[model samples]
Target: MSMERIATALDRVSAALRRKPQAGIHDDAAATARWDGGLRTRVLHDAGHELLTDMPAEIGGEDGAPTPGWFMRAGLASCAVTRIAMAAAAEGIRLETLEARASSRSDTRGMLLIPEADGSAVPAQPLEIALHVRIGAPGVPAERLRTLVEWTARCSPVGCTVEQPMPLALHVDVAS
Candidate 1:
């Protein structure tokens, strides 16, 4: 879709949300992941969408699909792109090129629950995450693009989620 159309749609949504603040609250459907085999899982989402995750052969997996961490990185990249596009459209900036690249470093010992040399606990999360965004537009200042990218980082859903961890509630049920 054209940026003008996107801007129009966004304006409509923004007006609606302003009129009814509660309209901005979104409750997403639950996504369930079932283990397909060793170190492999199949996730089911809305509209019959399915995603698969598997570790490398060295990790006792078939290496058939991307790992969960890869998916998280992909999500962050895609979400940043989406937010950037939206912001540019709203601001009437016609982008010639836009890209977001996300990368992270993970410690295997942390993931495997291996204790440190001092018998301390290691975090099971990525040690560092980085996102590099490239954006270009004709007749637009580079500083403006930088500001837009910074704004996108603050507003992107996945970016925000990764930056600020949320509380998770886990429930387990024993099957007969």
Candidate 2:
């Protein structure tokens, strides 16, 4: 969509939101994942979109698609960029270009069930996840842009998830 169109759409949404604040309330979302075989998995959403995840050949997978960690990083980057765009529109900040990157260092030994020399399992968590955002809006003060990026990180869902621990539950069932 054109920039003008996006601005118009955001304006319409803002107007409607102002008119009826309750119109923006949402409570729940659902998605599903199915394992095909080996390390291959397919994630399905109610919106008719699908994502494939797999492991690399070194980890005993055929390398059919990206790993789950890659998807997580991609999601963080995409969500950050999207939220930044929406916030910029709401604040009437004209941006010529925006870029976001998410990255982390992780040990796969535990995930792959590899034992250390001391017969201990390596930690499976990423050391840290970093987000980098670059904005190109001429004449805009660098301080203000930096503040906007920081605000975007605070408001983005994926960014929050990476920064804080959220409640999660899991259940296992067997198919007859």
Residue lDDT tens for model 2, 58-170: 97888999999999999899999999898787677889889998999987886767889999888787868898899977788989989999988888988898899777787
lDDT of 2 at 69: 90
- The per-prediction CA RMSD against the true structure, in angstroms, equals 0.9, 2.5
Kindly report the root-mean-square deviation of model 1 from the true structure over all alpha carbons: 0.9
Model 2, poorest ten-residue lDDT window? Answer: 1-10
| Model 1 clashing residue pairs (backbone) | none
lDDT of 1 by residue, 11-111 (tens): 99999999999978988877889999899999999779999999999868999999999999999999999999999999999999999999999888898
